[model samples]
Target: MNTAWIYLILAGLCEIGWAFGLKYSEGFSKLWPSVITVVVMILSFVLLAQAMKTLPLGTAYASWTGIGAVGTAILGIVLLGEPRDAVRLICIGLIIAGVLGLKFLAKE
Candidate 1:
């Protein structure tokens, strides 16, 4: 809703991008994917730092990681043929709940 939150969300998205880039990069062996991964990784950290300027450190960090973990897991399932068992889905749902709680219930 605010600029800091926006930055955090964008950072989370960048986190996801970099995660995929890491896979595509093949352990940094690929040129373009590795470069893109590094760039996105830097962007993610910068945006996260910007968010931390206003957000409480715990909330910001947890929410940022929560978004990244959830996004990456879902994408892994969809794109990389990862498992999609009920337990895994349930765990992901719990993570989503925790992230939403941090966003809406956090004082700042």
Candidate 2:
């Protein structure tokens, strides 16, 4: 795998962490989670920018956000007790497909 792809994946993971941090932060009322959220958000953006140095902007961004969205949605359902509807699950599958398509077809 390309270094940029690794960075992009790391960026996506960090994005997930940061998003969860936001939820855990409770509207920034809690200090620790809020601070962690800021740190993770910065790391995610930094990795994303690094990935953009090599990857196509549109493809990289779409993949990054796709990963974040899918991961977050799963976490929401599993960890946060969000609803698990059929339509939402199917939409998530489509997103996964699109992300996989971009990953396989995209050229470095």
Candidate 3:
């Protein structure tokens, strides 16, 4: 695996962190959560930029956002008491499949 991919994956995870942080921040009213949210968001974008240096922009952005969306959705269902319906779950699965397809088709 390429170092850029590692960075991209980490960035995606960081995006999940920030997304949760934003939810917990209550519109940035809280101090620590808001701070962490900003920090992690910056880190995520920086890592994504680093990844874009090596990978195609379209491929990298798609993978990055796909990972973040899937992870955040799952976490919302598990950690945040979000609803888990069949259609929603299936859509998430399709997003995962799309991410995998993009990865398989991408040139590295």
Lowest summed lDDT window (length 10), candidate 1:
99-108
Q: Give the Å shift of residue 87 in candidate 1.
A: 0.5
Residue 90 CA displacement from its true place in model 3, Å: 0.8
- lDDT per residue for candidate 2 within 1-108, as digits (tens), equals 889999999999999999999999999999999999999999999999999998999989999999999999999999989989999999999999998989997665
Least accurate 10 contiguous residues by lDDT in model 2: 99-108
What lDDT, from 0 to 1, does candidate 2 have?
0.95
Q: After superposition on all CA atoms, how large is the RMSD of candidate 3?
A: 0.9
**What is the Cα-based lDDT of residue 82 in candidate 1?**
100
Q: TM-score each candidate.
A: 0.97, 0.95, 0.95
Sort order, lDDT high to low: 1, 2, 3
- Tell me the spans in candidate 3 whose CA falls farther than 4 Å from its real position: none
Q: Is candidate 1 or candidate 3 better by TM-score?
A: 1
- The model with the greatest lDDT is 1
* Backbone clashes counted, model 1: 0
Candidate 3's TM-score reads 0.95
